[model samples]
Target: MSAETPPGASFPESPDPDRTIEHRTPQPGQATANDAHTRQLPYGQAEELGFNAPDGTEGAPAKRGRGWLLAAISAIVVVILGGGGVWAFSQLSGGGTQPQEVLPGNAIAYVRLDLDPAANQKLALLTIARKFPGIKDSLSDDDPRKALFEAIKGDSPDLAKVDYAKDVEPWLGDRAGLAVLSSGAGKEPDVAAAVQVKDEAAARDGIAKLAPGDEYGLAFRDGYAILAKTQAAADGYAKAAPLSQNAQFSDDTSAVGEPGVMSFWMDLGELADMSGAAATAAPTALESIKDMRFAGALRFDGDYAELTGITRGGAANTLKGQPVKIAELPASTVGAISLSGLGDGFATQWPKIQQAAEATPDGQTITKSLEQFQQLYGISVPDDIVTLLGKSLTIALDQEGLDAQQPNVGAVLTTDPVKAQAVVTKLEALLAGSGTPLQLAKKPGDGQLVVASTQTYADKLGTKGTLGESESFKLAVPDADAANYAVYVDLDKLEPLYLSGLKGEEKSNVQVLRAIGLSGNYTDGTSMTLRVLFN
Candidate 1:
């Protein structure tokens, strides 16, 4: 989240011409600006000022060379930085670089970012909340909103204390600080700012006019940033959301732009900074991306020392060595809003999570670590990573269950083997209709029941003959009753049952609930009877 330049903020002076190449990437799409704002959050009123979180792609410059081209450069940089050599790769290919070929089944990653320290801190505050379950009480006693204020105050201080041109760009991934660059302590607005321009000639002419920090507004809420299109087409987007009719067009002609243009196209360095930040932060956010199963791409074509391109063939050939590229694909944009104290957001609802984690092998250990991470960072655990953990436990149990004729999920527990087998026997009998609805799988651990049961549904839909592994709680009965149970079901295994009950388009409803359960419990002449609810 970059700083919002006050409307009509003065542009800073331009940089050296040679270092500053003329940017001519096209801006497509309507330049529609949203006036949306969130409800007054604990963070502050700044969030209510209607600055939507910019799409992650706002910073990736256009692609300019073959895939390996960037990777090849990074390799050289790594070597030079390690005191190997100072040679930088400058393999200039003809024309513009083509989009790297996307392979089938590859994942998409979208990255969203802002150079505004306040925004980062806003997110950081949320991250911090996850780590410290109760931070509101930790605020400075004098200031009611001291925590929020401190987070905002920490974005960037003393621009002169830092080299905006050098450190800021590298730090943020794009030259995000360019917007605040100063040629003199105080000076004229050197650059004109606008996002979209319809006039082909104005759009063409405008590219030649952009300075380093000049703002390029784009028209995306949250999606991939890598765009595949011609420069002219991309420029047409500026027309959709013009920076301003008052924006200076040419050094020679002060022509205004068309009215219908939008404001999505961002400055090259601005694009780079946002993209770079996203790239830099990706490793840390891997858990979230995996949980959401997100994927996407970003395009950049600026003088970024950090970004490198790698060719597909070149990348595959250099397998023994570190691949020429770092990570290929656009930054993901699934920004997670902190939900620490929404009455019953996560704090109250997590007992079920606690119970589930405790029942599995070392579930408490992993969950505790997750809690610690959140407390420290105020961020949520990525669902994909959590799912992975869940699946690992499931697989371990399933493998154990399969070892015997009519396997019991708990028999695999090596700890307290006696109790484990006893629970397994009880569970198997219940599942096979020979015992009670609830049966212990093992002794209670930590404050959770290590139990299992075979419950049925109304013809239990969604057994696509595949019986995908899906699980959830079986609606808890209040007042500390053992009847409050959670259940796991392989959706792939249950798809056929769900399909049998559905007719035509109704089958699609099951698709959304593919990984979850149904609304109620009903008896099916199958091995189990249980309840399925979205919650």
Candidate 2:
């Protein structure tokens, strides 16, 4: 059976299938031939009755009542004929294609595209382009959508005359989707795409005009048109389970946002296996990752255009309830990051790491390098180095020297004061002849050791005000106590310092980065969120 016709059925063809037919219904205000009072009676009565047609056609036939009934029946027949014609045309055009009919059962990834927001997305792009006077001037002749089409067509004269909105949009239904099927080991995957179109025949004709080569195999089923890399692949897709019907895929994509302009889903584990990495054992921390899905939306506000994405994964349970250290730095700090419960987490995952490392050639080399470093520093790799590193670490940048050019950047290791001091002393001695810039000192009345880029910052540490008291820091980290990991960047303070050194286009390109703050917090080990705020 032909792919255009469904099983056990066939559609008759029409010559003028593209022609549009309008069926108009009689309105209440209009005089109908069936109304008795509307008949041409006496002169005064006929004028008062308003029985004449709007265009002053001849009065109803002299036969009266019976003739009026026939006219009404004739109008009804015309209406039915018009409706049937449209359906017949659609069927002849192969308008019943569906995505499931063209996708393979074992597809690895699926992407769905919704062009409903195409106009809005185009407008947003134009608005962003208008930010640069030169670019805006270049796009002056054509609207954004037409301009984009021309750009894509480039030097192809044939594609320039194609009217996408008229010839393509009607046949393309609400959404278009694609599925990828793995061919086999060491071979490229097969790709199949399905689109819902209003006029299947028109879409097919357009496709033929645009690309007449045998590079793509085409089939139509239901109200969709399916395209595949090969005829066999397209035929197989017609019999396979669609990506939407796959239970695992459905479950994996549950967290993804719906009805967006664009959405994507991928089987991460399957992709890893395809790439040959699955041959090696993965770390326990990454064992739970099965798939990744993301959905994005575009928004324009005045001069800025923002794209936001929400992503979720299958590994939430594996990383739940992890604790993070909260750092207490000085108010003058420009950047800071803190992580808590590292020692315990590292201890649990270290064996798996060692095994995976030893199994690989690169890992073996790293092990040898670590052993050499331990011997050179006269410190045990795990007992002295790892033990002295403690459960949490905080790194921060703060003002220290006489000039802004010499900002103080340092790391605070929360460990036994005596052991941390000893490790610092050994590290400093090892770097004595290398001219590595570092100064280590013990924080007063605490078991923390500070390592700074300058001695002045090391001495001033824990003596000045704390970051917790700063308004910007407080705003960035509202729930500081609850977070197991936190990152904060004071863009307000760094913007001018960085911008002052740039000129012209280089400066304008980065102007969007100014007055923007970024912060992220990982809580409960299972969930992490980052936010970018514009001021």
The model with the greatest lDDT is 2
lDDT of each: 0.23, 0.49
TM-score for each prediction? Answer: 0.19, 0.60
Worst 10 residues of 1 by lDDT: 321-330
* Residue 401 accuracy (lDDT) in model 1: 29
The ten-residue window of minimal lDDT in model 2 covers 44-53
Candidate 2 lDDT over residue span 104-146, tens digit each: 5577776654433222232333334434432333432222222
Q: What is the lDDT of residue 26 in candidate 2?
A: 18
Best by TM-score: 2
For candidate 2, give the lDDT of residue 144: 22
C-alpha lDDT of residue 93 in model 1 = 9
Which runs of model 1 end up more than 4 angstroms from their true locations? 1-392, 395-411, 414-438, 441-492, 506-535
Candidate 1 positional error at 338, Å:
28
